[model samples]
Target chain A: MIETTQLTKRYGNLTAVDGISFKVEPGQVLGFLGPNGAGKSTTMKMIAGFLAPTSGGAKVCGYDVESQPIEAKRSLGYLPEGAPSYGEMTPRAFLEFIADVRGIAGDARKRRLDDVIGRLQLEGVLAQPIDTLSKGFKRRVGLAQAILHDPPVLILDEPTDGLDPNQKHEVRALINAMSHDKIIVISTHILEEVHAVCTRAVIIAGGKLLADATPAELETRSRYHGAVSLTATNTGEARAALARVADIESIEIDPQDHRITAFPKKGRAIFVAVSDALKAQNVTVSELALEAGRLDEVFRTITQPQIKGGRA
Target chain B: MNPIATVFRRELKGYFATPVAYVFIVIFLILAGSLTFYFGGFYERGQADLSAFFIYHPWLYLFLVPAIAMRLWAEERKSGTIELLLTLPITMFQAVLAKFLAAWAFVGIALALTFPIWITVNYLGDPDNGVIFTGYVGSFLMAGAFLAIGSCLSAATRNQVVAFILTVVACFLLLLAGFPLVLGFFQTILPQGVVDAISGLSLYAHFDAISKGVLDLRDIVYFVLTIGAWLYATAIVIDLKKAD
Candidate 1:
């Protein structure tokens, strides 16, 4: 298991990761969801033993990242932000160097190298210099290197940023397939990708985690209070009837279409009560359905834009 | 293979994989060879010795070695590859040693390519090959010294051009410390022992002794210790600047 206790990183006066704590169990795929500059990359780097946390601690397996860095790092495979690599070396050469450094030798090294080469499908450009390859190819090569040692824990930062649709699917499939054995934590700003490859997501904004749950649980949490759209024969009458239902926050009518929308505090109860109450008002209920909250909406709702004069 | 050896093998090949290595070797050889033969008056001395060749190596290396060593860490920092290399399981010392050896070996290759000059001297006269060998050894050690300084400077800056310029200036001053013009400037103001101590620290003075086949333990120790000291500083600088 991976655990952090009040882990924080401060640069001068600005806190990048502000006393946040979380955990990832074995065989779990955790998504680090955040907008740009949300401290996702900083937290990942700190966990990977690349950046020293300003306070508190992060532990990988059972080893402390700051004190037992070599041990912690040995069990972790990290693809740092931007996937930086040596431009002068070929993919094969770079991977070989990384394998050697990781102490994989002889047949084991070759076998693992072949496995990653095949998995990432880097055969065509294995011999090509990294500088000469396209961005997608370079990203694949970076991924191949990250998994070369098959470390038990994987921390990938924006792993599919440069991939095309087909390649993204393949990479997501690879991530899904590998999640059964490794503790994988992937950070990305793409909301759809969270559902695509993640089992649980930890969403952070303004350097503080706002939500942590299974994908389904998070979905439910965001939709707990949802908007319900209803069209009735008498729109104004339906609006008045729905407002009387328990937990119904507000109701608005569209004059042109004679349709009304209701935002309820308790989505499930209000949906039933509003539909029942509208019928009691002798209003023909044309449409009454609870809109499921999307990950995009949750991302926006939970992320409070930093305020300057309350404009945001 | 040992990890250091493995790193060395990869790094050694890294030099040949690009035009920078070849260009550096060719330019270094041409400049060193021309300076030794033309400016140092190799044939005019006509004493069946390699003093002329050995005398100019310090000045040549002041510029050429920095050109070779400027990219050792600076390029890694600029291209963001240092993150990849350093994050591996190896210690910083091993990485630093591997890269330093790769660059020094490239200089060694360029130095070796000047074998034709050795062959020419041998064919022309009964030159003392032992002295010539020692001179080559001194030259290589001095090259390492200059490279260590350049490597440290390279780690200090992200821009390769800035690294090159700073290394050149630092190395030029180290070389000129032994010149009469510089010593005379110091002689008027400083105590005689202080002037002597300053000049004694010059590469030309220690290298001059080694090139004459003296094999003084002190000179050998100075070069090795100088390389070690600067490389230790390089490691520290790397740690300080590494991204958080």
Candidate 2:
């Protein structure tokens, strides 16, 4: 288990991370969501025992981070922002150093090293210096170092930030593969990543926790939730026909694509009613979708007010 | 494996991982060789001793040791690897000590590579091998002291150039504290006890005593104390400035 109680970090007059508290159990991947400079990295640093909190504290596997740093850190694996490593060393040598520092020795050491190397596909670059490797290879090496010992708690800052689409998919798949028994915390600004890998997300803005919920739960707060959007042959006729449906509270047309969206009233399923109305008017619909929710819209709604308030 | 030993192994190998180690070792050997033979007048001294060689180490280390120490912490901070290092299951003191020891050992290797000088002296005439051995010990201790001071100053900044310049300036001041020119100036203004105290803290004074074939307990303690104090300051400085 990973637990932080009222953790805070301050830099002179600026409070970088406010009093934030949360907990993570095993088999759960927690996504730390925030805007740029929203203290996502700072909070991860505190939890990893890289930065001492100005107030409050954290515990990993019941060991206090401040008082029992060694014990807490022993159980934790952290990939710092930018995936920093000794650039002069090869992926093989770098992983060896990390493995040694993490106390993975003897037969188990080689096994763990090979496991991460194979998993991250770093075998080809094992001999080349990290400084000469491409950005994607460097990130994979960083991930390899973090998972070399297979620590129970893994904290990664911007794990997939610089990866290409395929690399991003592979890293997400890796996170999902490792989320079975580990308390993995990854911080990213990408909203779709939360849907892809996170079992729970803690959104912070201006160094304050704004919301903590599952991706599905947070998306439900979007105005687009339960809304039905369709591209039809006669958009105006379909809009008139949809007005007869009692469930839909409002209707809107896309200015660019001319698609019609029918928003349902509270606790109403508008997909069936809207389809029935479109068919009744003999309107030929080309494409239709019942949106689960618009996470970007919900993210903006949840975080934009504070941005305007100038809290960060 | 022990944490310090593990970090020490990596740090030491880290030097060989780049051209820095080969460059530093080659430069150190060249400078030490020429300074001993040409500047110190090894042949002209006509004595069966390495006094000429040992006399120039304090001056030689002033620039070269800082080159080694400057990158100790500064590079870690510049490349953002300090976060990865500090997050490992190692104490701050262990990290500081391991890095220092690795750098010190690297310098030791460079110093030992000057074995031809030892053979040259012995081949020239019958010299007291015991004195030469003590001089080697003293030179290694002084290098350790210099490296410790450099380690602390390196931790104070992320820029290696800044760290190098600050370490050079600090070590120069400490070395000059024992000089007659500096002591004479302080003698006219400060009290006798204060002047004596200043000279006592001088690395040159303690190193001079050891190099002159007198391995006094006080001189050894001075170097040990200097290494201990500076390494302690290094840990504290790293803690205070790491987040920046």
Candidate 3:
């Protein structure tokens, strides 16, 4: 388990991380969602024992990070921001150094090294220096180093930030593969990533925790939840027909795509009602979708108020 | 393996991974050889000792040792590898000590490579090998003191050039504290006891004693304490400035 109680970090006058408390159990992947400079990295750094908190503390597997740093750190694997590593060393040599530092020795060390190398597909670049590797390869090497010993608690800061689409999918798959018994915490600004891998997500803005819930639960907060959107041939006729539906509280036309979206009243399902109404109006429907929710809209609604408040 | 040994091994190997180790060793050898022969007048002294060689060590190390130590923490901070290093299951003291020992051992290798000069001195005439050995010990100890200072200063900044310049200035002041020109100026203005106390803090005074064949216990303790105190400061500095 990884638990942080009222953790805070301050830099002179600026409070970078406010008093934030949360806990993660095994078999759960927690996504830390925040805007840029919202203290996501600082919180991760504190949890990993890389930065001392100004107030409160973190515990990994019941070991206090500040008082029992070695014990806590031994059970934790961290990939710091930017996936920093010794650039001069080859991936093979760098992994060996991390292995030695982690105290994985003898045949076990070799097995672990080979396992991670194969898992991350680093066999081809094992001999090349990390400095010469591409960003994606470097990120893989960083992930390889973190998982070499297979620590129970893994904290990655923006794990898929710089990856291409395929690499992002692979990394998300890797996270899923490892989420069976590990408490994995990954921080990212990408909203879709929360849906991609996170079992639970905590959104923060201006160094304050705004919301914490499962991705599905968080998505339900979106205004688009249970809403139906359709692209119709006769958009005006479709809008006129949908005006008569009692369940839909409002309707909007997307300026960019000319798709009409009808929002349902609280706790109402209008997919069937809207479909029937459109069919009766003889509307030519090209596409229709009952959105689970738009995570980006919910994210903006939850965090934008804080930004406006800060500016004012 | 223990974290210190692992980190030390990695740090030592890191120097060799680039052109740094080979270049540093080559430059150190060349400077040590020429300074002893051309500047120190080893031939004109006509003595069967390496006094000419040992005399120029402090001056040579002033520039070269800092070159080695400046990159110790500065490069880690620049490349953002300090976060990776510190987050590993290792104490700050272990990291600082391991890096220092690795750099010290690297300098030791460079110092040992001057064996041909020792052989040449022995070939010329019979010399006190014990004095030569003490001189080597003294030079190594002095190098450690310089390295410890450099390590602390390197932790204070992410820029290697700034670390290098600061370390050079700090080490130069320590060396100058024992110079006759500096001491003579203090003697006229200050009381004898104060002057003596000031000179006692000089690295030159302690190293000079050891290089002249007298391996005083006090001199050894001075170097050890200097290394210990500065390494302690290094850990503290890293803690305070690492997040910046």
Candidate 4:
């Protein structure tokens, strides 16, 4: 439901969103991942029609954001960074205002307002001023405003930023429930959020799209650079015995724990051979398992190193 | 009604939903009453004209209108709500006009609260109430002109303090453009025709004509065109800074 061309956003000398193109089809929960100053928010803003791209264009539901902004914007709901809200208004009042602006009137307005408020669990604090509420509560109110219109496309920037664990779960569940009908692009720097919620992941670093893949694929890529561990009672015996195993890249002994950790490309087979060799040596194996790479590891390895270099 | 009216109603009600409308009305009534009776010298001048009341409005609005208008778009930018607002189905022109009209209507409500002064003037003498009524029209128009400029300036800055200061500076320049100090400075540098044209652009001149009970078409057109020009400028500024 959303497509971007060679979209680029430049602020004087800095290119915030550098010529990155991506598409989000309907019913896809696309997790937009990037570190700070990575242009995830800038890309989302361009797609939402809030910012005009410097070089290319973005389209929402087939309507070009620059040429047909009103139609494109009408089809999308955006929750901006920091979850901006009018502090003087209550949650109920703010949602009502958004409903009014969205042109949902009469029973539809009332029903949608009821649904969002109830789903966000904002009943108790609905009447309290937003400025008086906690940050988490305020974020819920922002979420309520975003989904009140129930647009077909949803672009949420840092949707679960300040929420406690329970509130985050509620928001995640709400997003998961709505994933069937909307094209949701959630921009966040949290790796665990991608694995937990997103159907697809797009990793961006230094204002460029670095990788686009599924969580499993990213983890598989992590495995290409990972190691397997083998822990035993006597590290010296285990290491010497496992030395005969093929593809045993390196071995390290932990002096305190007396554990032998092995680095191997064929993680599982090499671990199995090390286990058999240690068994032959009469060395009791305490822990012998292939360490599967995690999405967090992949995220750090792919995005963090480039961020350190501050490269474009 | 147009969809613009829908936006207008919501925006207008936003002011009343909080303490802004009530406080503005109450304070305006008290000050207007005091000005007409004691400070404006309505009875001491012993005149049927409401020049006393209308004369003080431009100065009163110099500060009051900015307080009402400083949040038109500045607060929206500061709070990050402008994105949500602009993404609605409404066009930018509609949103700009709706916001401007809402603020203008608010100033109208505050102006309407000064009716007790009108009632007092009517009760006291055979005043030309038509002249007084027309004077209010001119004052309302002038207030709208001031508000339009303030709204445009507010859209340019995120800080309300900066918006207020810039608005005061802009309105002050318009107010003093035709004054003797400014005119004297311009007489040496500018031709007489250009100087006359510049002085005619002053809001104070046309407003003064209407306050004297003269309903010249040119004076009415002047206020309308000035308001329209500033509002159009406001729409352009908003479109330029859409991201904020």
Candidate 5:
């Protein structure tokens, strides 16, 4: 388990992490969400024992991060921001160094090294210097090192920031495969990734926790949730007809495309009602679909600073 | 294995994994030989001794040893590997000690490779082997002193050039502490007791005493304490800069 108590970090007068606290149980993939400079990396650094907390502390497997860093670090595997490694060493040599540090020796070290290399597909470039590799390969090498020891707590920071789509898919699959019964925390500003692999997400803004909920729960807070949109031949008639539907909360019409969107009140399902109204009123509906929910909208509203006069 | 040994092995291997190690070794051997032959005139003196060679080590190491130590922490910081290193289950002391030992050992190798000089002196005449052995000890310890100073300054910056330059300047000042030029300046302004204390802190003075075959406990303590103090400062600098 990964637990934190009022974890705080400050740089001079500016607070980087402001009294943040949370507990992640086994079998959870917590996605840390934030905009640029929201202190996601700083918080990860504190829990990973790379930085001391100005006030408060974190623990990994009941070991205090500050007072018992070795114990805390021994139980955890951290992929620090930017996936830093010894650029001069080959991947094989680098993994050996990490394995040695973790006390994996002899036959076991060989097996573990081979397992991560195989899993990360590092065989082709095993002998290439890390600095000479591309961004995708470098990221995989970093991932290989983190999983080499098989520590129970895996903390990955922006694991797929600079990868192609295929590489991203592969990494996500890797995370999904290893997430069983492990407390995994991944930080990213990529919204789609949250739904892809994250079981839970915690949003931070201005060095403060803004929201914490499951991916589905957070999606429900989206304005597009349970909303129905239709492109009709007679836009005015369809827009007017949609108002007759039961529990219709709001309606927005696009003039150019003749698309009508209707939202339900109090989280009701509006699809059936909107469809029924379009059919019963003899409206010529060209297209109809329900959005999977606009998490991007919800993310923006919570992360962006609110204008005082409500203009933006 | 212990954490220090683990770090030591990796750091030593790190040196050879690049061309820098070969380059440093070549430069060190060439300079040490040339300085003794050309500047000290070892063959012209014909005294059947290596003091001509040993006398210039303090000056030679002031430039060479820091080149080895400059990249010790600076590269790690520049490449962000310091995070990976510090987050490992090793204490700061183990990491510092291991890295220092690796650099010291590398210098020791370069020093030992100058064995032809010892063999040459032995073959030419009956020189006091005991004095020669003490001189080698003094040279190794003095190299450690320079390395520790370099290691401490390297931790303060990520730029290797800056680390190298700062280490050279710092070592030069320490080497000059007991010289007439520096002592004259201090003597003219300061008291006698203060001057003596300052001279006692000069790396040249301790190394000179040991090189002369005195092997005083005070001189050994001086080098040991200086290395220990600098390494202690290295640990503190690393700890305080974790937030960076």
Candidate 6:
């Protein structure tokens, strides 16, 4: 379990994380969302016992990160950004070093080492220096070290940042495989990751917590929620037909493509009624789609104000 | 195994993982051999004692020890491994002491390989082996001093070049404190007691006493305290500037 009570970090004049609080229970995979400098990394550092919080505190498995750092760290596994490891060491040696520090020894150490190496497909680069490997292999080496000891809480900062699509899917599957028993926190800007893998997410910007909810809840807050869009002859007749639907609140037509869109009143689903209206008016709808809403839209609505208002 | 032992073994092996260990050992042997033969007149003195060998250690270490110590923390910081290290279930002091011990032991290995000189001296004539042993101890202690300084300076920056330069300059000042050139400047403004105190802080004087065939408890304590103080400062520096 991991919990932060108003955790904050300040570097001289700039506040990187301002009094943010949340808890990650066992079996919960929380995706940390933010723009650049959103304090996601800072918060992860605090929980990992790498960076001291300027105020407030974090606890890992009930151990206070600042006061009981060793205990807190014993329960936590952290993969720093860029997956830094000893470049001179081969993947085998680096994992052995991490296993030693993590107190995995003898037969258990070998078993865990082989397990992660096999799972991450690190056998090809097992003897090669980490610096000589490609970026994806380097990331796998880091991931192997992180899960070598199998600690209770894992804080991965951008686990899939530089991975290709297939590698990203494999890593996501790995995280999903571990999510049933571990407390995993992943900080990322790739919003689709949250919808795909996160059980919950917290959006932070300008060092402040903007929203904390499940991916489903956040999607509902988008302006496109329950709205309908159709390309049924973007002509005036189609626009009037879309506007006359009972539950349809407004009709917006794209002048360039002549596509008609209908927004429901009070965020209700008006897809059936609008579809029926188009049929009754003899307007053949080519493409009719209803939105559960887009996470990108919600993310833009939550983060764009800071960019416009000039938070700096 | 203890975490310190774990860290120490990995780091010690890391020295050999690249060309660093071979280069350092080769350079050290060449310098120790050449300096003893040319400057100390090992052949001309016709003496079996290793004074010629031990005499130039402080100067050799003035350059070489920093080369070994500059990468102790600087490389970790530059590569971002320090974050993974400090976040492990180990204390700052443990990490600092482990790296220092690894470097010290590495230097010890280089020093031990100089045993051929001892064999050469003993084969030539009767020599005071007891004094020679003390000379090795003194050399190791002085290397520890230089290494401690290097370790502390290396923790202050991520750039290895900057760390190396700062360590050389800092150790140079410490060494110069006991020299007449610096003392002459200080004596103009300072009193006799302060001058004596500054002179008492000399690595030259303590290394001199041990190299001259006497093992003073005071010299041993000086090296111990110096290594301890600098290592403690290293721990504090890592804690303070590690995030940078």
lDDT tens digits, residues B130-179, model 3?
Answer: 99999999999999999999999999999999999999999999999999
lDDT per residue for candidate 1 within A273-304, as digits (tens), equals 77678778887877777755578777877775
- Per TM-score, what order, best first? 3, 2, 6, 5, 4, 1
Q: Which residue window of length 10 is worst by lDDT in model 1 chain B?
A: B82-91
Residue B244 of model 1 has an lDDT of: 32
RMSD of each: 3.7, 1.5, 1.6, 2.8, 2.8, 2.0
Model 3, A1-312: lDDT tens digits are: 999999999888888889999999999999998778778999999999999999999999999999999999999999999999999999999999999998999999999999999999999999999999999999999999999999999999999988999999999999999999999999999988998999999998878889999999998999999999999988898999999899999999999889999999999999999999888888889999999998899888898876632210
Q: Pick the candidate with the highest DockQ.
A: 3
For candidate 3, the per-residue lDDT at A209 reads: 88
Provide chain B TM-scores across all predictions.
0.95, 0.98, 0.99, 0.94, 0.97, 0.96
Q: What is the per-residue lDDT of model 5 for residues A99-142, given as tens digits with 9 covering 90 to 100? A: 99989988999999999999999999999999999999999999
Error of 2 at B145 (Å): 1.5
User: Model 1, which residues run further than 4 Å from truth?
Assistant: A221-226, A229-247, A251-261, A270-290, A305-312
- lDDT (tens digit, per residue) of candidate 5 on B1-244: 7888888988888889888889988888898899999998988998988889999998888888888889989888888889889888888899999999999998888899999989988998989999999999999999999999999999998888999999999999999997878998999999999999999999998898899888999999999999999999999998887667
Interface root mean square deviation for model 1, in Å? 1.8
Docking class of 5: medium
Q: What's the TM for model 4?
A: 0.92
TM per candidate comes to: 0.90, 0.98, 0.98, 0.92, 0.96, 0.96
Better of 1 and 4 by DockQ: 1
Per-residue lDDT of A1-312 in model 6, one digit per residue for the tens?
Answer: 899999988888878888999998999999999888777888898889998999999999999999999999988889998889999999999999999888888899889998999999998989999889999899989888888888889999999999999989999999999999999999999998997789999998888899999998998998778888889754777887776777877778787887776889995789889888889899877898987788998998998775422121
- By lDDT rank, best first, the candidates go 3, 2, 6, 5, 1, 4
lDDT at position B137, candidate 6: 94
Local accuracy of candidate 2 as per-residue lDDT tens digits, A1-312: 999999999888888888999999999999998888788888999999999999999999999999999999999999999999999888988898888888889999999998999999998989999999999999999899888889999999999998999999999999999999999999999999999999999998878999999999998998899999999988888888899999989989989999888899999998988888888889889998998998888888887866632122
Candidate DockQ values, in order, are 0.60, 0.83, 0.91, 0.57, 0.77, 0.85
Can you tell me which runs of candidate 3 are displaced by over 4 Å?
A308-312
The best-first sequence of candidates by DockQ reads 3, 6, 2, 5, 1, 4
Point out the higher-scoring one by lDDT: 1 or 3.
3
By TM-score, who's the top model here?
A: 3
Cα lDDT listed for each candidate: 0.84, 0.92, 0.94, 0.84, 0.89, 0.90
